[model samples]
Target: MRRSFAFKCTLLVIGWLLVAIAAVQIPARTFWPAAFVALTLPVALGLNLAAALYWLLRNWRVAALPALVAVLTWPHFQRGLAVHPLHLAGAAPKATAGQRVRVLSANVRIFNVYPQLREKDPASPDKMIRWVASNPADVICLQEFYNEPRPSRHDGRLFQSVDRIGEQTGRQVFLSRTLTNSIGAEFGMAIFSRFPIVRRGTITFDKLTQNHAMFADLRLPSGDTIRVFNFHLQSMSMDEKDIVDSYSSKAGLKAKGLGLLRRFKRGMVARSVQMDTLMRRFEKSPYPLLLCADLNDLPYSYSYDQLADHFQNAWATVGTGVGSTYNGALPFVRIDNQFVGPQWVVDDFRVHYEVPYSDHFPTTAEYRLK
Candidate 1:
């Protein structure tokens, strides 16, 4: 009798969880503001599936509840996982002549500038720079790109990463600084392109955060101009202890948990405002737009819903699987993305996971302007 009561109680709790998971899909954060809870939709969906299986094994009629919830939430799962019709061999569409332009977006975590990460691999900065140079995408959008003017023995003269990238890839470099000290040394977002930069500027967020977005108008070989918006939206900015490892004590854990929760709430509110501002700005853009960024928010939230609903997700149209770009301790999250307007066709899209130096992986998308 005790076991029967426990089983029924567990089933009831699972039913409520299933309802909560399905409800957040509507993106009404004002009504249901636990954005961080919505981030665990994938985990919730998986749990529902497991519960369905368990109930089926017990020959229980209540199995249908969890199964139905899982099916109804399948579209959210599909966005993160690729379900091919058949296990057939295939390749991305190849570019012919001047037909396609490849774009890459990455957040390099200030090129692993922290002493702890650098201590693990002394050659990380050099390796990362080489990797970026090797990719040679037509246009590159990098967040947390740093430039220190101090002379380095290896590179000599000045520690100009932007110039080095331009030298290696032969692209016009445009940078926008969110913060700068009395000295010229600074860190910010950057855009590098093979084509001429007709115009470039920054989109200032009124939020007090150091992060910002910028746009560059590049004139293509065919004389058509396209504006590329490189955004690094409001970050959760969780403490390093919350990220690198678990807290040791109960108090430390609780404090860290509360800190993260507070940051998540602040980030969500700031991001909502940022998204609204960007959409309004984009509405006036005269050229075709390609938006690339590390949107710290997940795809299930209001911010992502608004962006995905308006722009074309390069991955949804061409790439497969979760295409997860975040490679740090946090697993199975695709925070990096590329969204294009209707004036372009996504020939290919992929998350480059092989490069392990940064906390986030680089994402690339090949496009053909229509």
Candidate 2:
């Protein structure tokens, strides 16, 4: 009778855990559900081991419940680690110095007003501009390149500012026109190169948000023609009403649950579409490619996986320590990245967080042609 009671208790515990796991998905908060699933898998496996040990001592069939939990959760654990830092490190190829190119990638946040950083101080843009001027890079890519819409004193000259800086450093600047008419000005992606650009063009993706990829064909000192593709992917902006309704106190559990499901499905579908479009562009490029962007997806995500199949992450090769690039108060991940083709060798990589010119920190990688 006591053995039967223990078996019931063990089954009850396992069921409880399973319910909690399902609940995480039901609310459809992608990051949280994914994280919860990841963390619980290991614990479930450890519990199974303990149960097996206890079962050997007391001869109870209840031990199978924990083992079943382990079997069920193992996939989730592996999937979580699929996007971990270690995997990123392992995927990078070794570096060589002969064909070295130093490159910088930064999202200037469209020069938007960020109150968190004291924008009134002259030091804000000055520091960022100074870094760009001084950094010894062969190529520099800037996203969210803003120009004043009207002929205002602070507007039309944005590109000139970058160009002048590049000229001072002997780097030629190539800016792509993504948004011909944005609210503040015309904005897009820009590339400044120390090497002469042989060709350049823009690749557009169908996204729920306005995003684009800019390409530059750079002729290396080694006589190799390499293409650099810089891009910004779709954002997570939902309708204002939808956001309010999902999170508001008046939203009941069922309503919130359904809302979350719809949102998650929408985001997933949108990202898939964007990735497909970008991948096609990458496929069409003839030259050896070096791609950089704010992917907006986590390292272990499907988007990252698809890109990894084609390009090697520069950070995983040469970067050391936690390379988080977002500068928000709660920043905890490296969403910014530089990916090079198999023929490139990355010698050094860095995340520039101290330069507070934008919400996203700049990333730099030194690479050599093989």
Candidate 3:
């Protein structure tokens, strides 16, 4: 009798977790705004589904509650694990009659030029240049990209990576530096395009650490002008040592966890403000807009919802499967995305997992004006 009572208590606890998980889809900034709590929703959904299966094996009636919650919250599951019939057709064709353009977005993470991974392979820089040259994206958006005026040759000549990619691909490159020195050396986001850039500008966020969004107006061969915004939002900014030390002891765990949570909260709040700043400018744009970004937030969060509310996500229309874009230790989350205006029809979208140069897998999409 006592064992059965304990089982009931455990089941009750699982059910409440499922409800909280489902409730996170609420479209608001402050209501249930904690990232730690929001991050558990995916895990809770998995546990709930497992419990539903277990209960069904014992008695069909006992499984209904968990099963129903999972079913009712099906949209969230669909977002993370979708399969489409269009995969057999492959990516959309490149521009032949000047109607379609292929765009690629990637956060290169400073070309992996840190001290710890110095010995791994210096070939990553060349690999990226060759990949972009061979793959041939018409427009490329890069974030967390680095540049140095007189970087040591040992640092892999990342100072000229932007110009190298442009020369290799025969595209025009424009950069927006979030960090700069007095000697005209800097690091920031960049946009490269085959089409002619008519104008360029940067949108600076007041409270962000080292991130900014920049826009370029390109004149296509068809004479259409479109504005492309490449943005890297605020990141959690947790170091590798922070993660390793967190698990070393109970005190360390508590301290590190709190520190990470504080960072997460700050990142989310800052991203919200930055997104609002972008949207206001986006509204005033004279041409059709395309947004390529490393949002550092999940699809269910307020940050994503607000940005996606008006724009159409390229992956949702053309991508198959979960389309996970992050290549970090936690593998399933997709924080990088490409969003287009309604005037474009997304013919194909894909996450390039083959490129293992950075913590993020590059995402590419082909679209034509509707």
Most accurate candidate by TM-score: 1
Off by over 4 Å in 1: 1-34, 43-74, 84-88, 91-98, 149-158, 207-209, 243-255
Using all chains and alpha carbons, the TM-scores for the candidates as numbered come to: 0.80, 0.67, 0.79
Error of 3 at 208 (Å): 7.4
Q: What is the lDDT of residue 160 in candidate 1?
A: 67
Q: How high a TM-score does candidate 1 get?
A: 0.80
Report lDDT (CA) for all predictions.
0.75, 0.66, 0.75
Q: Which of candidates 2 and 3 is the stronger one according to lDDT? A: 3
Model 1 lDDT at residue 12: 64
Candidate 1 lDDT by residue in tens digits, 1-370: 8548746755765665665555444443354365656666666666777778877777567678677767876766665665542221455444464447889899987777567877878778878877886786999999988776666555563346786677657988898876665656668988999999999988888742347889999998888899999998888777656844435667766657677767777878777778888889889999999999888877766677677767888876776667788776566677888999888887777777788888898888789987
Task: Give the per-residue lDDT digits (tens) of candidate 3, residues 1-370.
Answer: 8547745854765766655554444433354355455566666667778778877887677778778877886655555565456553654453344378889999988776565543566777668756765667889999987666565556545556666777656889898877776655667888999999899998888743458889999998888999999998878687757866788788888889888767767777777777778889989999988899998888756667666668878776666677888776664688999998888877778898889888789988888876
Taking the tens digit of each residue's C-alpha lDDT, what string does model 2 give over 96-145? 45677889998877654334554555456545666777888889888876
What's every prediction's RMSD, in angstroms? 4.3, 7.4, 4.5
Q: Which residues of candidate 2, in runs, are more than 4 Å off? A: 1-97, 112-122, 148-159, 180-184, 207-210, 238-265
Clashes of 3: 0
lDDT of 2 at 224: 84
